[model samples]
Target: MPSRFRAWELCALMLAVGSAFTSNFAGADEKAEGDIPAFVGKDSPVGAWEYGKERGEFWKYRNEKPTATIDASSVGKYADKLTPGQIALFKAKPGYRMEIYPAHRVCGVPDFVAANSEQNKTLAKLDASEEHVVDGVTPGVMFPQPKTGAQAIYNYLLRYRGVGTSVSAQVTAVSPRPGSDEWITAVGPSLNYYPWAVEGHNKVVGGGAILNGISFTYVSPAALAGQGGAGKIYFNQDAEAYYYFTGQRRVRRMPSYLYDAPQLGYENEYLVDETGVFLGPPIDRFNWKLVGKKELYVPYSSFGMYRFNAKFDSVFSKSFVNPEFRRYEPHRVYVVEATLKPDARHVAHKKVFYLDEDTWIPVLAEDYDAQGNLWKVKEAYPIPVWELGGTCDFLAFTQYDMATGRYVSDQTTIGQGKDVRWFAKATEPWMKSDYFTSQALQSRSDR
Candidate 1:
């Protein structure tokens, strides 16, 4: 219905309008760039990428992209020799240095753990399918020479921690404001039970259910007294949690308490799964990649941090735990990166875990936000439990929230004397399965 010239004019106008709209859209994106925090060091690669991508930027470096690997010829005497990319990934400051020492393979499991691991390995090899089954494996390290990242994670999950351990430990969660040494501290006692670690009980018990259990009851600051909870981890599924409110006098089941859930009175920075660096199975929520081996300055053999005479105030320093009592040693660690799946929901978009090769215990972890900014750094200090035939255990650990400057320290037995104790073997009556029951929790609280 229109002339050729008129049609041409209309097309020109439409193109002009489209160009203007695109220019405006691009301008808006440029303006929004300011909202993103300035990228530091090698983080510029991540700034250009959008958050919540199906495959995160860290996954790009999963395989051969990261050419650096720890070996006998590599530099290992000092942390200063670490690559800039490595330091940047850990969010360590420019001047930060870690004193490296000779690698020691001091991790030793009990006879039971060694025997069980051998059996588990055989069972695992028989299955050719990719389907991950919980019941097929026994206790101890599931896969000693783990080829995939998921297998390495499973090894950590099943690492030898003795058969049923009972530990009385204290948690010191400190929230400090800027320009003040004053820190609000929440001190409390916690009890841990590892039902799966029970000796002579290799098969599944209690109607073929329940794996591990923990109960924590705060006994300090008056306001938080008698306010704590208990949680049970299943063999194949997520954990079931319950919180005790002193006022209500009832234990309410909290199914939503798994993964990224905040610990009470800890400023919501420390997550349930973030405890012990990486807790529970991460197979479903994340795509794990084994970044290979690297010599790292990780907290190891830090028995001094658990001294009975050490005072909490002396050990607690501004911004971080005191380095005097903390010991760092050079150890070959398997670097594993866990990027959140697109369907998974969590505050931490990416997590980098450093696991000791000898023990398979996570020694250091870096957590990143959705915006790809480093949010928190966690360190676990390992101490060899001599009574358990040199079995290495996490003596104490700290999680630092970089943005908020708040931190949480758990498993601290320092200065608690008789109130806190770590035993290689569980105490006689407490080792019973009935001791971890929900009914038992209510009855114990009543007493």
Candidate 2:
């Protein structure tokens, strides 16, 4: 089961990173940045100033390691701004289901067609009585509100899927296309247990425990290939923690593996790259900045699910790992771009993230190449709602290589539900460092 129980919250107090009591946090005004406390006397192995140390488990895993610590208090500070409904939703025990659908009906105008002599002559003289108007209007002109990548997904979850304040299931099925795998099914137990799985490389690679309706899994790229492998992860249910039997090595949740750095506006954490590689150590560091927001059209948005899913072989090759080959300056968020300090470690070229500010979620990301060219583009959209409140971060995404016209998309499916206790009990024998090796994955059952 993927642990999505606000893991940052649990670790917040220890690292003093996400404490709501702190002043400098997300959504806070820029002026407040100056008033933030510095990392002077904290016992963090990775001080705020020395965030991106090039040594430690984090370094070995991420290769570059984190250059700075993230401010833990920031989580609480920003979380406070959430509406009561949003807060309740975030804290809800019921799992959530997310889905994505591609809408066909491209641009058109029914009224325009009806008034156009050319269109009426063609239709009236032909046996196309089966054709309908645009949204009930004659000639069927489409409304301008093109279903955006995120909105297309959100609407399906809220409307067709029956996702709301209560539990429900929704259809997330899509026709199997030519390029990618076919659509899969998922069900949640009591709106809390959500099952999201991914079939990659002609193999079932990503899926995990759906305990008490909430769990998360980060399948390794190796597993995505249907190869015998796993990924490192963080998960919780019913107040207990369980480390997944997979992921890149060197991930940990202990104080020794943790660091604090108020100076960086971050605390109590290590950093990892897209491949599940950790980027920082107990002694690494980097500088943090909250760049302004921007709207963007990311590639592989849900709108193209139907057409793109069928074009898999044409887009990706077995050797493709970010074949898009992008880079960045500071940091790389899935969708939201954040700039990093020049001296930062483990980060690609300077980058920008197209994150959904409303959900603090990312949808599309762009990476620069060594030459600072727009080498790669990664796009993701939310899945439909069946469980887990029907609202999720992203259902799937595709990374594209503009130079070679090659790409790879990771589509996902939710899984069956389970009890929260299942996760709590599972956590009893787990350790943060256990995920760093292949032997650790083999020993999960015994643990």
Candidate 3:
């Protein structure tokens, strides 16, 4: 049986989320940049220095890591702004650093959506509670007010990043074994497409059964030189993972690779749902509670981490990723906590995520083991996807195992010449569902 909040408790929690909007949201007119309700930082409007760089800044960050950094001695100044989980992580992995940067604005989902947002109106109309979204919500956020824990996490789960995105190359890195400096690493390509992603798209495709489809193939190291897999992330279920097995010379389904399963070669350092901080299954495994919307040090406008050209050695480290490659900013985030269901089973007993309020991206998270001990801490490296019309997306993210002193980074672009390519429409040939089928996986096998 799943634990649930009492009716009155649920109402109070919902009110907490609403109060966040009141405390953080500037007036609509002030927050609006030109015609688009430009999303900047929460609790503060965009600074003059942060405006106008919307799309260019994203690319510029990719080309060059930011030069300015917060002084190491002054890191304590941000102690009050960090979650207890983060402070615990700092203690677990000492010598972590922060890079301070301006929170630039991005043209948001307001400009190209058909969702029913604030009178069928938007992120700008967070006050309008008169049913502002379609049952089959597409393009824009569904619950801008986000009354429940499920609603808030759903915003993250469904936030748009265009119709399709393809990263030509993505690097993976895990810390060295205990008492040694050598590291485990792999590289691969990532593909994601949303069948119901097109603007005015979806009247609930398959009754909102499918949120997106993903495919990936890794070609590196002798052990994993030719492994590939495809999975469908449905609206309310576990992902279906399958891949072509080169040695077997056929596509095989991996049903057990659903929740909490460690990715091959990661040594249990990374779990399936740990991608981009929190991604698939028993997505409803816990009873969610909306803690509050609060200001915290979260990864925002992180371009340095995406430099496909950055040297791998510069980023991967014995404890956490190099502090220079990771940036932290003061932004408002919706804090949601999940406790495992009484009848459910998973390695993590409790989890907390601070989702960036502006983009609903989970910027920071903490996972607790079955003993209720904080086991891991995580962060996502998000840069505004200018290509996705300012809708932000994370290009890289990682988690640290506090118990083991190991960290695994996924979806990184460092050393790859190209970054994630965001599409405004499903125009590519491989954007179809068939491209993710087992037959397709076999045809595209590395071997």
Candidate 4:
């Protein structure tokens, strides 16, 4: 057998052992069914709620109506309806308005995703312990009709973002200084492999027990060229990451690349886990609360931004990514609040996520600082990939730092050639589990 296959086999064995232990202690079969709560607005079934030591402060279901729903064409006319924070971030330009339309269920899951979701629902009832395990999930959305915040998040976590995606993109950071349009950009190639989403088992390239693998190598801006990193995220364990340094001609393990670590020297504006709106593990750090469904204006089906001839200056303006190409639609979103645990430590104290009901992808997120004030607003521009039979988000996302006026736009194809594309299916034969290891990082580096 090949060495890579043997490594995967060993990984699978370890996962089996881990699952057994999880089943025993995690109470995989404990059901949280009970009388449905009398929710006010859009009533949905309630799921399990975990309690914190802070008495009377535990997170609970908060089902309520949206503050206001306006048309995207008349967003400025009803500017008073928006919160102060909303107005500041979405300041409308002439001939453009942030219209909030009627809500619709536009998200559609693929058959495989639906099948896996049904299987996950059954497994959750049979062994509640597997509720958060991503390794054993059968290639689909984990919780289709999520009742709790955690379950809703799991839907995003396990959402089918393609089995593998390879893109040559760019990351641009705009300086906060006034009258300074100076921008620092990093051009690179990014490969993301979700082993858990791969169909069947291919010992050479399939992820035996891992959830996802990502590798990125910067190819431009001379100084950052040759700097690369690879990481593997497990279903029930801490993620493992490694960084390749050209000077040393070696790869070094970077265990601290979790939570709020600055990503690729983006001036601390972007965190490692903030990609794709909310991408990291959520069960342990934050106590999530499902705040019910609300109608909101969010970016949806933005096909214009994906044009091969799009320019960076036209796409990215001074204050915000020009809203001209941004398409907004009214959609019922599952509002989830994540509060930093008292025991856990992080920069953001609170985060409110707006997940589209249809796609289960976070469209907008408001990050609060230590003082409980809105500090950063993150937006995900999702477009439907017709070939994939579902919506794919974050083709271009902007992270705006309210305090600093600086923002970072990652995974953007603006300015780069048309080589940047989202593959609905895995096309690369080398997208295997072994290809994301630290050793692979060293070998792939162009030193």
TM-score winner: 3
Tens-place lDDT per residue, model 2, 341-364, is: 466543345444454322223445
Q: Per-residue alpha-carbon lDDT of model 1 for 82-158, expressed as tens digits?
A: 53333543344322334344334445655545544544545443123221444333445666566777777767766
| Weakest lDDT window of 10 consecutive positions for candidate 2 | 196-205
* lDDT rank order: 3, 4, 1, 2
* Total backbone collisions for each predicted model: 2, 97, 7, 11
Clash pairs detected, candidate 1: 163-197, 164-197
Per-model root-mean-square deviation over C-alphas: 21.2, 25.6, 8.8, 12.4
lDDT of 3 by residue, 1-447 (tens): 012225464345334444223211222432543222344432222333232233333353334444345434555666767776677765666677666554444424534342323211232221122112225345556666766776677677767778888877777888887898877778788888876667552343332355778898777756776887897876544567897767787889888886788877777888877777887534657878888877676787676677666778787778778877777666667899988889988899999999886677889999998888888888887766555555567858888888888888888877666666778877889987778777788778844
- Model 3 alpha-carbon drift over 4 Å, by segment: 1-77, 105-107, 114-116, 119-134, 205-208, 236-238
Better of 1 and 2 by lDDT: 1
> Against the correct fold, how does model 2 do in TM-score?
0.33
TM-score of each: 0.75, 0.33, 0.81, 0.76
Ranking by TM-score: 3, 4, 1, 2
Candidate 3's displacement at residue 321, Å, is 1.6
**What overall lDDT goes with each candidate model?**
0.59, 0.26, 0.66, 0.61
Better of 2 and 3 by TM-score: 3
lDDT of prediction 3: 0.66
Candidate 4 stretches with Cα past 4 Å from truth are 1-85, 91-106, 125-131, 134-136, 200-208
